[model samples]
Target: MILAALAALNVALAGPWPALAGSEDVVVEGAWARASVGTSRPGAAYMTLRNTGNEAVTLTGIMTPIAMMPEIHRSTTNDKGVSTMAPAGEITIAPGESVAMAPGGLHAMLMRLQEPMNEGESFPLTLTFSGGGKVIIEVPILKLGARGPEG
Candidate 1:
């Protein structure tokens, strides 16, 4: 009972983020998202993933309560400077390698958001890996179109 209460307190005070599973070999850093213009518009999240283990692992899925569907996506610009976003398949990280998700590049798409993602707010997201390892991260909502966590 005390442990449960402490856990609840931790979330309540720390943006409702779950503690990271220490056993997971993959580490997530600088997880954040942009504030949604409106509830009708989808939002995007970014982060950096580093593989600490000695083997390669594929990031297979993303799950979040704030959005009805979350997907992996990549953004590319044509020669004419028209950029398009498309679904990106699973991402693989080799041992001691790192992957970064940034705006106008690779990112996580939040479709059918439950509500507008406002600045100063945050949400939880779980990333699943091929070897059954999972990392639960809290993504803070930054200013609309913000580049990084500092903004």
Candidate 2:
């Protein structure tokens, strides 16, 4: 009885299980999207991806039902103090490492939004990896001008 109680507690504390059994090498957390302004067709999503396995994984693609087109992007500022956003073809995460997608850096770009993403709403984002692994995560929409998910 004690063992059973401990097992239950472990599972409960672990939260939701991975999508695929024995495929919990990669985990995503703290996913969020910035609230959209009126008539804005593009938005960005941010998350932290961690790889706990002994192998590296490459994030290749992203898809979302709320957007007509989804792509990975990286924001950079040049020497002239000009900020530009460009497509990030792919991102790799080494074993036992974590990658953060935050503002002014790497993010998932949602183009041609089907509808305005309002605060307190959530949407699904499907991420595909190079090794045929895929994970569907629900990203929450935060207030406009929010810097991070903490808000």
Candidate 3:
């Protein structure tokens, strides 16, 4: 009886579990941001987004208090060897598809950083989806030049 009571209490305290990016239908993993130096105007955050649901979902927007503006961006190189970054509008993920955000590719551009994002620090980032699903996640700050999360 005591064990059962404890289990019930635990569930009650835990409340209803929300579906994060990488769980039931949508999964988000490997979320990390590049560390910023003094007075840096922008930073980048990378992550892998997976869609396990039956229907497609559009990643509508991102929000964070640490940056004045957060938007999806893509980096590309031209024939002249010049690289340019531009805003990427809504990104769609099909069923059983995974999208990777990495260096020189799609990334979350944090413009006008409110403060220096030092390494070893973590902050909250919210991702909004087209189906009214939102996921709040903590993004770890990695070294400025780190290539990926393993670094």
Candidate 4:
């Protein structure tokens, strides 16, 4: 909800954020990752995927050079306010719709890191879709505790 509101305000106040060029109809924006303190812990990444095509697309797989295991996950808060995260498998986006991967929601989990992700550094993350083909976006590494991409 927070990321959606921020995006809406950005569009209303300024304009739509520029999308990362892709091979198909899905465009990505605001791709970022939090800097890792060391190689022991996994890192999380976030982005928004917009579908501009007429058909629905399912995001199937993810890959990045920084980690050995990159996967999609969804975080949810239960009725008791306990938060849990689980593997998301695949996500389908309808035509003209969008899926936002923000904090406390759907996001990418970069696990088994080969090296620590430092602030101000960036890496390419490849996402494969069932209908929309594939997209490789550059995800910037922000502060260790950043909740969202830097403005």
Identify the runs in model 1 with alpha carbons over 4 angstroms from their true place: 1-23
TM, every model: 0.83, 0.82, 0.82, 0.82
| lDDT of each candidate versus the true structure | 0.86, 0.87, 0.86, 0.87
1 against 2, candidate with superior TM-score: 1
lDDT of 3 by residue, 1-151 (tens): 9999999997785465344433347789999988888646798999999898887777989999999899999999999999999999989998999999999999999998898999999989888887456777899999888889997
Q: Which residue segments of model 3 deviate by more than 4 Å?
A: 1-24
Please, what are the lDDT tens digits per residue for candidate 2 over residues 23-88? 358799899999998536699999999988888788889999999899999999999999999999
TM-score-best of 1 and 3: 1
RMSD of each predicted structure: 6.2, 7.7, 5.8, 12.2
Superposed by TM-score, candidate 2 places the C-alpha of residue 90 at a distance from the truth, in angstroms, of 1.1
lDDT accuracy of residue 98 in candidate 1: 92
- Greater lDDT among 3 and 4 belongs to 4
The lowest-lDDT stretch of 10 consecutive residues in candidate 4 is 14-23
lDDT (Cα, tens digit) per residue for candidate 4, span 18-131: 233233888898999999999999999999999988877789989999999999999999999999999999898888999999989999999999889999999999998763
Cα displacement (angstroms), candidate 2, residue 24, comes to: 3.3
Worst 10 residues of 2 by lDDT: 14-23
